[model samples]
Target: MRPKIYLFGDSITEMSFEHGGWGASLVNHFNRTVDVVLRGYSGYNTRWGLKVLDKVFAGSSESESVLAVTVFFGANDASVEDRCSAFQHVPIEEYKQNLHSIVSFLKGRWPTTEVILISPPPIDEPTRLLCPFTENKSGLPERTNEAAGNYAKACLAVAAECGVSAIDLWTRMQQIPGWQTACLSDGLHLTQTGNKIVFEEVVEALKKKGFSLETLPVDLPVIFDIDPNDPLKSFQGI
Candidate 1:
């Protein structure tokens, strides 16, 4: 069975297969080496994510092991409680607990699977206000950079406590001058540049945890090495 890497999160993850998306980048990077399983639910927070964890993971068997799992959420969870999108709001304390629970649950099911937590990217309030999705809506830009930063710190804390890796996108994105205009498209979703940043950070984090495609055996034979009349020979060992 092929090794698997699961990307679990909210809309950020769900939309990651789009052209130039971070998830797509990973898919291409690990092509033919591992299966990239996307379990993203648009607009979901950690609380909602935990409710469906079992359905998504379904525990790995001895024959099929999960190589890594990236738990990326918080964008929706950071929604202001009194805002228009309050339905997706999760309390700060609960957010932290939920992240811990997610890590613990996944670890229990697949002890060897690497867990990488990704905090929500920074939000651009002005751009969000101008976005058609939020332009005429009340309580516009329901999320703030500060609120997202808090969640990002919480996510990092959870990773440290669980001995896993984390990508603090909230903090990292802001470090880039004028990231507000260059990274996110609607203050919430990522643009191509934002996706590229995420893809690079995720790759670096995975490498630090010893996940390297260079060491992983390809799932199929190189096309050039396969004989047209004797294809089985190239796949003999596999």
Candidate 2:
């Protein structure tokens, strides 16, 4: 296959709607430079991804031609279980363990892979209210800056521990003015515009680390068939 960058994550990663997902936006922003392989699955946690790593990897080979791998997760893991479902407020330790497993699995399977860990951003309270399921989950409250920060820190620590590149989108999202309003339509998910903001920041960070769009093939197809309801879809128009 042409050079590919596989994206592994939850709904946020899979989000490719009409306007486009973060992945699509990422592709458009760098279309002149790189092509992408989308593998983001909705409602999946790091724990579950570990179980399906083989399937994920089976889609691509470990050849040097593969450009990179980006993993974006944690929103669903932090979600609160409601009405008998696994909740978001995953204990910090469990979250850490789950992430550790994912990282280890990646390293073991592709020792030479260029891995990137992207921390999920803080949720907007009103955005949370927009989703009835999330609203009903009392234990899983809207994401506070502190909680979001903690999660980012944990993710960063894990990435460092594993010696991989880390993208701290949480802090960048929080620093923006009217971030809550511009970033999220509800409390937890991003709006279309919000996703653009995310894609831009992530691309900038990647560029800083010497990842240029000029490195990948241009004929690779873009994956934009994302579900609008997906958490990552909130960033649809953005």
Candidate 3:
């Protein structure tokens, strides 16, 4: 049977566009072999994600099996309001703590579940430079993306510490040729082309991990191994 993968994030993830987000594209690319769940919520931070885990953790079971989970947060958490203008810049310390809580809670709930931490893509120059509110934020160019990159790396460090896996979207996203145009629009979120590229990359990574698109079913359902009333239940398969 194909493995199930769940995606968790905010607006960048909430909309898949005509080509669908990476998650949806993953499903389509695999042609119903791997089950993909899109639990993207707009304007939500990691704080809000924890509160809404129930809907995101719906698929996975001992019988069906859950392969992995990809987490994309820190966008909203990074939002900052400077001189009457709002930006997406979460404090480094608060972001770290939030991630810790998120990872700890998930690891506690599903010990065997695989977790992946994805950093947000780079910010667009025009938006960051032109936006009157966010232009003066501490991390204008390098710092903004750096914080997110660091956050992802932190997750990688934690994953390594905890013996899990991590995907460096920030690093990889930067490497793509014409990436500035291929992967982002308005400094955030994937354009249709961007989502496709991400999906293809994810598929490649999954293949490297031994997951075959030929094995999963397109419309597979999620499985819950624990009781619904559990506090950690919200994070199962997350």
Tell me the TM-score of each prediction against the true structure. 0.91, 0.78, 0.71
**lDDT per residue, candidate 1, 107-216, as tens digits?**
88789989999999999987766663333467366787889998899889988999999999998888888898788888889889999999999889888877778777
Clashes of each: 0, 25, 15
Model 2 lDDT per residue over 1-238, tens place: 3456678887777874326467888777666556677888987767777789889888565554555678887776665433223444566677778788887877776686677888877877555555645335454444555666677788888888888888887887777788887776665567776787667766766776667665444443334544546756645555
Candidates' lDDT values, in order? 0.87, 0.69, 0.64
Prediction 2 global C-alpha lDDT = 0.69
Off by over 4 Å in 3: 1-3, 58-64, 81-89, 129-143, 214-238
Off by over 4 Å in 1: 59-63, 132-140, 224-233
The regions of model 2 sitting more than 4 angstroms off are 16-20, 80-89, 134-145, 214-238
User: In model 1, where is the ten-residue run with the lowest total lDDT?
Assistant: 131-140
Please give, for residues 31-123, the per-residue lDDT of candidate 3 as tens digits. 556667777788677767777775566444445566767777876665543422244455656666666667776666666656766666666
1 or 2, greater by TM-score? 1
Global fold similarity of model 1 (TM-score) = 0.91
* Candidate numbers sorted by TM-score from highest down: 1, 2, 3
Relative to the unseen true structure, what is the C-alpha lDDT of residue 114 in candidate 1, on a scale of 0 to 100? 90
Q: In model 1, what lDDT does residue 227 have?
A: 95
Give the winner by lDDT: 2 or 3: 2
